[model samples]
Target chain A: MGAHSLLPFTQDRDTAGFFEAAAEGRLVFKACLDCGHALHPPTDHCPRCGGWNTAWKDAKGTGRLHTWTTVMHQIHPDFPAPYTLVVVELDETPEVRLMGRLQGEPELREGMPMEVWFEPLGEGGPVLPQWKPVEA
Target chain B: MTATVIDDELAFAGRDKAAVVGIGQTAFSRDSGRSVLSLATEASLKAIADAGLTVDDIDGIVRCEQDNVRPYSLAAAIGAKNLHYWADTGPGGVAPCMMMGLAMGAVMTGQAKAVLAFRSLNGRSEMRLGGTGRHDAIEVVGGFGSYDEFYLPYGLQSAGQTFALMARRHMLEYGTTAEQLGAVAMACREHANQTPHAQMNGRPMSMDDYLASRMISTPLRMFDFCLESDGACAVVITSAERAKDLAKPPVLIRAVAGGAPQDHRPGMMFPVVSREDMTELGGRQAGAELWRRAGVGPEEMDLAQIYDCFTISVILQLEAYGFCGKGEGGPFAASGALRKGGQLPINTGGGHMSEGYVHGMNHIVQAVRQLRGEADMQIPDAELCMCTGGPLPIGSSVVFRKAA
Candidate 1:
């Protein structure tokens, strides 16, 4: 039997691109040629300027762990229960922020030190970068 | 004060006319055992039914939907004809206000006669529950997909953690306490105790219980958070002229507004005041605009259904809407002023905290019910009501009043 996620949710196919890159350990963003704001979840137009002049740019993945949650429930049908979800601030560019989960339980807190780890998938997918506790 | 929105006093006045007329909702639970589409249809149908109409009676549709719930499909399922007026609002909880805007536009320009607005989620199945660092990656949508990927390689994993940092920063800067956040939770529960459909029905919480609840992140305890519930909710909007014919009295949409400030260049724009950045001020401006357009004061509202996705959002909303000055939100919330029959009876239907989370549409439904004097814990002569998605960069709000 499949385990359940504590907090479950579903994204449309339109939002598949962002997840695709994160699995490969690449931080990709949508850059608008108009007002020049990097878009998230990959949109056709710049939400800031309403212009569709957009393209992709991958960031150097480095940012602070802004906030996070250890969901006691599953957000989707695919995951197991009570996983950690985090939103990280990318240091390479202020415009890009991403949310996912911590690799495994390893002591959590607010303003606690954190860093990224690109774990290679055993099932032949690209390497996946996840958040984990960082030592000082 | 960084742009036209900041200086626009016309948008900050306290009186406006957009009042809620009709309300509808489905039972909420951790497992509703229904597909997202089914739940959404049920809620939409109920709302239309409650408003004394058929699906065909509505000329427009608006929804805040995810993958399982599609806008066009919802329109088709609900049998809405000529659904030329439809909108898919996001960042969560703005679906109704977005629909309100669409309905208003239709009424103003003579494009549509009435509108139906809805929001839905199925956390039990056909859904991914939360955004956490545990997932290797997330699908990208309009904005979250494009720019949000930049931070994935780092440790930043979810919205809760992001807000946790905001909470810590606030605590560090202003001596805010976890108990203060607990007080907010208690206040929400105090209102929840009276509602029947609330998930935590009859569950009483104290500041100690809140502090003792499992810690999701420091400063954000288990009780400080809102539960993930599977459910759907809907609301109907019609011109005041047409509303007189409905089953429930018309609650006019006095004024409605929403915004996302431009400044939080990299993050979700937490620590709204600490950052003092230009972009993080949209919510405050939106609140100011609502008050200005509606022509009423915050104290004048009979009840409020402020979204409680988390206790922190409620605190921010209090500041954003001027329920209290910045930094005073903690104490203001602790005062139990939002309890039922208190200064501003909020979320009498338990809100997202005590009630199952149906995104934020349930707040709108409850607001309409309160205005109709039909709430499970009704406020006496509640002629006016206010509801919001609360603290989203792209969030929405509306005020309602009993019909003349």
Candidate 2:
């Protein structure tokens, strides 16, 4: 089963760009262009500065692992057991955090360098962003 | 962040104004094989009867948010003449205890003479909250708008994974161990062994058994999660003046307070990933205020019946409620202090982890039982108890005392 059947993706103005960029192997984030305050999940107004002048900026697709869990129980029909879910803090700002599947060993430690990559959304569906260990 | 010390004068406004005169519950099982409405009606009737009152005396009804059991249907079944005050509070686990505050407000304001606060869920037969196939996530209507987009995609669906993430962070920060989590499970199991109504009654748990349990999520094993019980619980809240003539001795509502983190938003607890300190829970945010309002500190509480949807919740509550300092929860839990006759007995009625999940309504029942000197594992001279609801970024808590 592909994610297209199980989960819905954003096509709206707020999140379409982030998903569209992910579809094209580019990672982007939302922020208040005025105060340079980073935002996540994209909103209409800046929570920090109350500015509606939000901007979608390119992200480096790299961050440090903050925390993660290895799910051993089957939590979804499309996704089987034993997948690593990670919460990563972007290298640019600690406030800008992202979460996704970690694509390697079940083992995890805090503060490990990680980089973002794209993967087909569950058996050749829409492309989605994933995290992996950054090699030396 | 500094904790808010509630203003003493303002905090005592609700003290001794209302009291819980009756507690009632249905059989906790994997399958109730009954409609949620029926369960709710049965529990409400029992609570009313326990308070030595009839449907006509029940002038108000309070429900937990998202409950399939509606006040209108419950009123119809109970033949309530007038529901002067009817309300619900949410998002689930935290709302049960908070319901008391609502009921108290209704009674104190003369909106109603007696209020029935209850929760009923066919958690195992009709639904499973801890499992993957939550209907709410699939329906995607109501309040779960953008919040679902963030965490549900990565197969991080269940409460186990979400709470495990919190446990993992606590472990990293305080060097907490899985064994400490095991101690919480073992303590509850020990209490369950004595609790006749406990779902896990007669079953014993050991440190080795806990460690051997299958890992549902990295840090949380199957034993760490609370049971998905098919049951209902209800309590009757009335003025202390009325409670003097009731069937059971009144368990005075010392105080009831609730709140969320500063940045808390509805649907924000899915992963709790963004906060700088994930260990800081909404319970901590509400704790200081709760105690100040109750006019009692943690030292005076004879026991605590914390919401134990997960073992980590009880641990987190201990730290947040000022029973122990931050980062000291693991050591405190593992120290045998929570066992009966220990320094601070907790979950003496087995809690949700062992007794049953009434969405925390059972915690209130257990608190009343303990204070009345009626619990199976009753602590001698137990006159004060604390009941907490959910350990999320936003939660509720109550302090109860034996009638003075």
TM-score of the second chain for every model? 0.88, 0.95
Q: Which ten residues in a row have the lowest lDDT in candidate 2 chain A?
A: A1-10
Candidate 2 recovers what fraction of true contacts?
Answer: 0.41
DockQ of each: 0.12, 0.45
Instruction: List, in order, the clash count of every candidate structure.
Output: 95, 0
Clashing residue pairs in candidate 2, if any?
none
Write one digit per residue (lDDT tens) for candidate 2, span B76-145.
9879987878998977898988998999899988998999999999998887887655443243211224
Q: Which residue runs does candidate 1 get wrong by more than 4 Å?
A: A1-136, B1-20, B80-84, B132-145, B262-281
Q: Largest DockQ belongs to which candidate?
A: 2
How well docked is model 1, in DockQ terms?
A: 0.12
Which DockQ value does candidate 2 get? Answer: 0.45
Candidate 1, residues A36-93: lDDT per residue as tens digits?
A: 7766545666757878788767766556665555545343444444556665666655
